[model samples]
Target: LIRGGRVELGDARDLPFTIKRSWARERLTPDVHPGGFVLGCNMTMHRDVAARIGYFDERFGAGGPLRSAEDTDYLVRAMLLGIAVEYVPDMTIFHHHGRRDRKAIEKLHRDYSLGNGGLCLKHVRH
Candidate 1:
C-alpha cells in the first residue's frame, strides 16, 4: 500500500493542489475498496506479488500512445490473483512532473481515456 502526489519542484507558491488533496483524503477514508483504482506513482506491492503478477504491462505507461493504465492493469491482475491491495495514506511521494496548464491537462485526460479503453479491450474482451 502507498499514496503519492505531485509537488512543484523549487516552487514555494505551489502548494498541494485540489486533486492531490482529494487523493489523500480518499486514501485516508475510503468509502469503498481501494482496489477500485491504482495510482501508479504512489503504488507499492510485495516482491512476491510483483513476481506473481509479472510486474506492469510494457504496453501502457508514460511516453507512449497509451500514456497510462499500466498500474490499472497490474492492480486488476493482482486482485484476480487474490492479492489484497491496501491504501496507506501516510505513504506519499512528490511527482516532479505536474501539468499546470489547461492544454496539458486536456491531453492527459485524453490519453487516460485511450489507455482505459485499451485496458478494457485487453481484459474484458471475451
Candidate 2:
C-alpha cells in the first residue's frame, strides 16, 4: 500500500482544518516519516496485493454504521499478513470537505473513535 497527500481548499491559517491538513501531510510525506497507517482517500495497491488482502472491510466507511476506520482495518490486516505499506509524498490529492464548524469536527472525531473501537474488537480479540 502507498499513501499520498491531501491538501485542503482553504488558506493554511484556517484553524482546525489547517491543523488536520498539517497532521496528514506530515504523516504521509516522505520528508517527515512514512505514515503509520493508510488513509482510504490516498491508498494504492497492486491487484495481487488487493486480491490477497480481499479488499476493504465493508462494515466500516461512510455509508456504514461505524462511519470510518475501514482503511485502518485494511492496513492492519495487510501488515499482519506481511505486506509492505509505503507513503508516497509526490502523489498528492486535494480535499475540499474540510469542516469549519466545531460540531461537525467533533462528530467526525466521535465517529472515527467509535469505528476504531469496533475495528479493534473485530480484529484484536482472541
**1-126 in candidate 1: lDDT tens per residue?**
333333223343433332232334443222343323446666776676678888578788786568877777776676667676655555556655555677776777787788888887887756
Query: Model 2 misses residue 40 by how many Å?
Result: 0.9
Once superposed on the true structure, which residue ranges of model 1 sit more than 4 Å away at CA? 1-19, 22-36
For candidate 2, the lDDT comes to: 0.63
What is the per-residue lDDT of model 2 for residues 52-94, given as tens digits with 9 covering 90 to 100?
9996788888788888888777777776687767655555565
Each prediction's whole-model lDDT (CA): 0.59, 0.63
Clashing pairs in 1: none
